[model samples]
Target: MRNFLTAIFSKDKSPFVNAKAATSWCKRLQEIDMQSQHLKIHAAVTAFVSEERPTTLDSLSALLLIDDAAQPSYEAVCYQYIANPRMSKEIESRLWKQITSFAVDMAGVYQLFVQSETESGKKAEFALLMPKVLARSLHYLSIQAKWHYFRFEKVPSKLWTLSHQLYRLSEIEGCDSNPFPLYTSHAQEVTSCADEYIQMLMLGSLSNNNLSVRQIDWVDQWLNQWSKLIQMSRKFQEGRYHLCVNLQAPEGVQKIQAESEGEPFRYWGLHDLMHELEETLRRLENGATPRDLGMGKECPAPLAVELLKHLDIFWLMSIRNSVVQRSERKKVAKIADIISGLDSIIGHVRFDNDKNVRKASADGRGQVDYDEIMDMRLYGFVSTRTKEKPPPNKVVENKQKDWHVWNIENESVGGYGAVVHLSENEWVRPGLLVANRLGRQENWHLGVIRRLNRLGDDEVYVGIQSLALSPIAVSLYMEKEERKEQISLAEDSTLGVADLPNIRTALYLPHQIEGKNVNTLILHSADYGTDKIYRVQARERVFMVRLGSVIEKGVDWVWVTVFVISQE
Candidate 1:
């Protein structure tokens, strides 16, 4: 029964999913309460798997598309869903339980398969079952690693016990099918990623927090298991790369064969796996700690910074594959891309830099930005991003987000200027996040404020560079509604409009602002309780901005949603 359940969820189409009716039945089973109906479904799955199943290629047509909502919905409900996930609470503990159950179940099943190998009668029967059991077990381990490491939602226990058990079973000469070093390597990689993530969070959140025994154990185990996996899995590639693709598929290699018909998908290739592992580790290096995104407040709040800090991972993926539909993910990807293109500073012009820009332009790749040269006075400030450790080359000192006020002396399309008063200890460096003055939200539309020139002893002129814009809108408040302030982008002000939700209409775009196009929100105010979606027709692509963490009652402009919405 246990093995059959694995088969049903596994990448391959087993007899458990033989026909349209069977697939429909599987979908129905997902909707039913997993706790109440698991036993019956287990029995049905068991019965189907015991029979001789079809191996026809035609069955491939039944697999779900990448975007099919039902597929993720089913997976979410049965294997990894929460009834109601509060940002304040850790995602459904059932996912943790299910993960634990699979690890335990697979260990027992491996033992049973090995013991049953003795009886020739059983060996013939177990052949088909063993391959899938090995495959599905590996498949879910990747998922576990993703949620635990990539999402930083939960901490994961080491997979050493289960991998070791399978390793011993594989050593048995005729154990039907052999499990490869895939388990061993993955066990180490997944565990290491999780440990590093925890350690990083503790460090980032470490103003007054002490390292607990649990954190120590996590770090210690990661150190212990990483060595063991290297020894057990054998040093095939050595230090060249953590993962690689196979030119011709080898029998000993662990691969998800079904998803590709004749090929594998899940952490199968060396290149993809290496990229996956590196990407996860990089998140720990540069992103919000588990403490930042986790449900528990005991962990510590994320280093106060832009959403961009938590979004470094998205920048690693190709642009097309980059964006996810979720509001936060979409917002992060868009902002990350937006900031990436803003790497232009008047200082530090490598000769080859213009060559690269010209090549990129000839490729017809980026947006054609026209430079507007202007001079003006504006108020701005500089704040450093929170770091996990003191920067190596940087002078040893405070790493917190230190706010220092500046006087903006000039402006341009690419960047703006300001005279900064830095203490003797401080230096105006390149690639720092500058809070370009946008009303009360000082850090709104952040740009890199860098050293342009020296005016005198205490004043250092700095430039803020980016292709950024902000629109002024009246903020409406609704308790429990996610976006506290919705920017109504209409030409006519909310004068005597019948639906007068908020009487105060004193909203103004920053003085001296130009080149921002606006549109009208259909309803003057968002509906009584729920959030309202406004259809805006922008002459050009206009964005509705949301600043990360400012929810207060005021007339001053603040972004309710940081990610942009296309006016078109």
Candidate 2:
């Protein structure tokens, strides 16, 4: 058996025998259109790298060539999955595992090369390899961090420890400040080991901050420029700087504490970076072009300002201290059987109409069964168009199979941290609007999902921010002059004013404060227009209102303030 195994192993040859060979192989792999084929090729390369254990200068050159060539495909797959909320769980898991394994294997190979040169007492080779080692190791670590951040999950402690150890290793070799050309297709930008280290630290600090996938991507893009402006050193710097990292701790960068003591710690100040960001923001606000100010070409001025403000808060204070305190509790809550959207929220909240109430009373029940309500609402609410005026676009059918039963793991003034079986709610994602009924309560409160993290294959945790305690269902009609003209030209002059067309379903949320006259409505994204007037019909009351600025918006809904023009 030993002889046979040796023969089989000896027959296995490395595709990366030389730099040119590695490049050719990578080009062939890139030419393959199927992602599944790429996965197969990646697996084979990974196995060879891990098991063959090539330990020569020629092998190092080939490995670097392969790394540069393979990165684009791996990152493309990673972002493709991250941006898609409705991706299959099985495919996501399989692809993510392969990508992460590739990163780990690549980083390990580079680290091994550094170790081999150091132990062999080859000073010249070691000096030449140190900067590449630091840059590649940090780049791979950043990939791991990006994986977690995009998934809205916390990075593992072991990963943080490994990152800190790499930065510490660079310090020991006196090459922490050595510059190397980081691979990019656009320009040959030079970066140091310290810059990469700080980028990792900044990424770690953003965990649990409830940033959406797009916002996280924006931060990652801006960090490429912002990280260059940051300064790190062993000595404490003057000014209002609070960022520090302890090399001995199994954590990333954190707020500096006056009383805490730790050796071999690095203090990084963001004062200079903050100044640059503020200056750029000022120019943007004053009508400066984003590309001219070094921002991304596609990024708008408002988005640039929003991202800058978000970063400013983190640089000025500790995220842990800034977060709201959540009360730890284990209580089960009954979630409604409705997919998140303006239509679903309105349907669920308005289920107890006069007709349903009368039917329940006649049957000797206080209210109808929630499950029956869901069934009726889902299948029986298709809208029909009239010959004169067609109804607005029909609401999409709800796809939920059953009610979500979530366990309230924690609670705070703003929201609840809940967990449910992943199989029960595969569509749950950030920015999803949900309706929850707690403990047999008749009234259902509305909330939006702000964060989501999978515990494993079976369960998922989500953070939901409460929006409204008791949202009232209302119908809205665009208050166009043409609408008034149509009403006047009706065949039957007795046609009521409420019988107009283009009625859109919306939710009316009352003011939170008792003496405030503020009114807000959650409407479908298509129904909202700047400065458009709307006639609101709420059960027995009718009023004319005008749309105000949008407070928040999602894929399917928009929350906007409204002013009551007149009540009848």
Candidate 3:
């Protein structure tokens, strides 16, 4: 009598009455845009999966159709947030909550199907559903992991524990190696539960704390193709294999030990993955185009090589131990001023006539009657009469407003770990180049944001890596005929004033003395060209130099090694 009541209740609790109803719902969802569809689908799916009774096959059919329809919306949401990490907190929070809830709901629905099939004593149905269940569960779990990493937040332990448990369940069911369609968009592309698990492990092994959001996205995309090369095993191998994960550890992949002490662990031998990466690097170094090497056209060979090399070192080498010792100290540091972009940094460091430009009155008109257009232009405001855009390397005006105050929680030789309560308009992320000075200090130092963690709605913790101690601003001119003509005019002038063309503003890092042969120059990204020679004007000295390989690059600046051609 109890079983009969349970059956009746379960049948009534199913989300869809029949398969036709589910099909019609999916068809209707297709008519709407992806952004709107996600909200509706999420709401309905959440309600359906929240039922108390066991999920039925009819509901499973609806769930599968819903999952298929939700893929595009899911991808759209992930791309939106990952591509624009600095979006408004309200929108970001909403998207994060929705996407996270959707992933959890989908994973739970699939887990229910697995449980229901197993308990029904239908071996054939269980066998058919096992691979799909594991694949979908891991897929959604990977999405959750990526969103967490993009925000630089710690992924919950339950996520990893459940991921491991799912893969283990697949292995026990003898379907871990079976192939299934992972996505509706790419129905022909089949993958196994093992491959999905390997991809998760690879993602976990990345040094996400050090990589930019875009870099993390690239690694995630590339792993879709690269994870197939990795092989997993139950037995521990020697030097060729090192990475492993304990199924019961509730953590990510780590270095394997010779003996596991009878714990359930899976080992992944990265020999093949490393070999492929090394070969790709060699091909790239041999002048093979990125497109020819199967990388997209937008991917430069150098960038591809850099990413591959990073992955190679991360996978093959043992875990790195930090050598720099940090000290905890409580102190207030006025971020005296913060500046990003080569133009902004140069503007702050250099003396320019723009600072002397006349100010605008209450009506937004220049006070000075003479040279009104020139004054407005110098003030870095768009003029209706001129309609001229600022030069690419022009210095920005009125930078004092970019300052922030922080509490330095720790100090080290390399950088500082500071926390700040940021205003709505202010934003910071990893890979941002910043110039900071201590409170009441006149000297400014250059650094890059290496890590960032949100402590709360308005509070953020940042790890900065100092680049130089006393960088001086300088003018760099292309060594072309126009520049040579300007130099001749200066030499021939009685007043020693030459009307030179607008040259690039670059930061000369005096502390980055790379021996007597090489120096470092931080120049605007647009101003950097391969093998370009430049005449650099310092305070009292002038020299000609040729740019070498790029040491590092950001959205607006490039740190390139320079070789001295001559000194005047």
Candidate 4:
């Protein structure tokens, strides 16, 4: 009946699972055999072997033997069979009786460890499972080959034994599969199943807070291998693609199983494995342990930084064979932006001097550049461009008419016919012509702030280089919510408006009053033939301003000006 029950419950639960179910099923059978304690005990023994139940010396002492003398018999049966070289079906069955009794006697051990605060109890619990683990392992290996010294019988010891082995491997070996079939599908799968079962058992045991020696041994052996098995399984499956694609597909179950076993440890490659192993060993020897960090909290900023590190690995493995989704791509792009912003904040440090930027504009990758930022304390006026009206709607005005407009030139008879102003409407359709400013052409003679000071209650004194009208606007990026603060800076005063023209650049001049700090200088312009100069200051402030004109053939010159202000 026990054999029949074992066969029914011990089948593969899934492709990725192994047969560790027999252990739990046998325990359930014990409850059903209430009338026959011997039967219950026999069932326990069978369950123990199949489930790799621990067979420690202390565990056998607590079994409810028919008589006190039978207790010694139980111990003798367990230790002798486990340590004995001889084997027979009858002898194995008798051995199963003692082993199961021992497991049942040791039940609730995990609960004791979980609940008890005493270190001695915990250590004792850990130590108790060693013998059972050794015996079970031997039984499992023997049954795995479907033989017991050239004889075969209904031995379910293989299942629990596999779980125990898997748990141990995971704990010791980083649990990654190591190009061995047993490590991946066979052994690892059993380990996974056993882990689930063991966790359930441990939970139950913890509630009791008192487990017999056998149970303690069982829990320890099972826990030891559980994590490693999981790691091994994942690594093996992940790297399987590389093996299959690069080498060849595994032919049969045995071969596939064998390959899965050792593939994970090998997946890291020899050099990486060596380094990782060395590091791990160093930690172990030094008694230093890795911190147990929670997943989300432990992750780095700019998720892309983490992803980028594994891009090469994913590409080469071709493991998943799936394209990244558009949403995922967008997320990655956002992460990339965050990463770049962080890099900028930290101030970029380059390993080698960039020579490309020095060579040509097209080659700007490697270059060392610096910009000095100063807080020029100034309080100047701010203004906006006047909005233009719709074109004249009268049809009579559109008709062709004899028109003679005078070419008027108001020239300063002596001090150079320099500064000129056109009506805003006329400036709208402005043309580019070579006009002289100082010693340079109007297009090339970019403006710069010499000084800006409050002239009167409604006007601000300003000095600029360009001989044309200066047009300017504040060009600082402020927090989205800080617009109120920015507007309040005008203090309800009628701020001065400037028609600063060709104002490609503006600098906040340092105040002669030594202690006053100059704050802001704004520049305004339409797209000129100039390159935009993006600037980042020490105070995490950033601004983009047009510097001068570009002499390219297809590029059009744009009109721009500058405005100045200060927070003093």
Give all TM-scores, in the order shown.
0.27, 0.57, 0.59, 0.17
Q: Write the per-residue lDDT of candidate 4 for residues 1-568, one digit (tens) a residue.
A: 9999999999643211212333333344445433344344444444444564343333332221222212334445544554444668688676664455444433323222222313334435533333333233322332222222112122244333343443343344332222222221133334332233233222221211122223333333333333232221325443332221101221101112243445332221222322343443345335543232111222232332222222222222122222111111111110001001111211211101111112223454422211111221121322111012122222221222122121222222111111212221121111111212221111111222222223222223222222222111222333332445445644545552222122233222222124543232322223232443433222222444333432111112222332232221
User: How many Å off is the CA of 18 in candidate 2?
Assistant: 12
Off by over 4 Å in 3: 1-102, 113-125, 142-154, 167-179, 185-336, 351-402, 481-497, 510-518
lDDT of 1 by residue, 72-170 (tens): 333444333422334233544655555444434433333444444544345555554454344444334433433343222333334423333333343
Pairwise lDDT winner, candidates 3 and 4: 3
Q: Could you give the candidate ranking by TM-score, starting with the highest?
A: 3, 2, 1, 4
The window of 10 residues in a row where model 1 has the poorest summed lDDT is 370-379
Count clashing pairs, candidate 1.
11
Q: Choose 2 or 3, whichever is better by TM-score.
A: 3
Question: Which model is ahead, 1 or 4, in terms of TM-score?
Answer: 1
List the global CA lDDT of all models. Answer: 0.32, 0.68, 0.69, 0.28
Top lDDT prediction, candidate number: 3
Cα lDDT over the full model 4: 0.28
- Per-prediction tally of clashes: 11, 0, 0, 50
Off by over 4 Å in 4: 1-40, 43-223, 226-253, 257-568
lDDT value, candidate 1, whole model: 0.32
Which of the numbered candidates is closest to the native, going by highest TM-score? Answer: 3
The digit string of per-residue lDDT tens for model 3 on 443-518 reads 5678877655667556677777788765667788775756676777787756454466566788876333334434
